[model samples]
Target: MKKIIVLFSLALLSFSAQAQEIKWMSFSEAIAAQKKVAKPIFMDVYTDWCGPCKMLDRNTFSDPGVVSHINQNYYAVKFNAEGTEEINFNGKKFTNPNFDPNRKGRNAMHEFTGFLRVPGYPSMIVIDEKGSVKKTMVGYKTPEQLRADI
Candidate 1:
């Protein structure tokens, strides 16, 4: 019983120590934070039904090194490509005009997604503090690859 308790305690401590979470903010919040801190914006454009996007979340984003680097260097934003939420970006309002609430699998893409010109799922957009796009990376990238790209 004592041995089991010690092992359980060790497991708890290990889990806590490895819990390095990235501070993912909304698009508006990321923009707001950029204005204050002058850091570049890193936006993760994903759809709820995208498999690669889910993989990115489960793999690359979950890596501690990637989380630490992103948190320190950029204002991270998670934007749902097919979301219905209205967003005000660069003095313009964007929304998903064709969104169907009852639709399953795939839905209408958000206006902001079009504005960013995201070609596919699991896209990563990097914008400078001046609100200009710096880079647009498509598809899935490992933590090391993401760090190298950024």
Candidate 2:
């Protein structure tokens, strides 16, 4: 019993120590909060069917330094490139007509994607403090590279 308790405690501590955490925030919340805090938006645009997207999420996005920097410098938003939700941004509404709400692993494309033109998997879109787009990064990037982007 003593050994089991010790092992469980050690497991908890190890899980808690993993640092890379991209924030989980809604688009509306990020935009509204950005109005108050004036921070950029760091969005992870991914697809459920994309393997590389999941890889980046599990690796780079899980780094402690990357999580800290993103949370501090930007309002982290996770957007599905093929999600079914209707996203209204800057007076425009974006949705997927072919999107099946009942479908698994597929949805609608964000209208913002059309404007941003990020037709790639695992893209990172950065919006400046004033709500203007600063840059868009695509594909899997190392934690070091991701830090530089911020």
Q: Report backbone clashes per prediction.
A: 0, 7
lDDT of 2: 0.81
What lDDT score goes with residue 44 in model 2?
88
Residue by residue across 119-146, what tens digits does model 1's lDDT show? 9989999999988999999999999999
| Residue 143 local lDDT, model 2 | 91
Q: Evaluate model 1: give its TM-score.
A: 0.90
How does each model score on TM-score? 0.90, 0.82
Best by TM-score: 1
Q: Model 2 off-target regions past 4 Å?
A: 1-15, 102-108
Q: Indicate the residue-level lDDT of 58 in model 2.
A: 85
Instruction: Identify the leading candidate in terms of lDDT.
Output: 1
Which lDDT values do the candidates have, in the order given? 0.92, 0.81
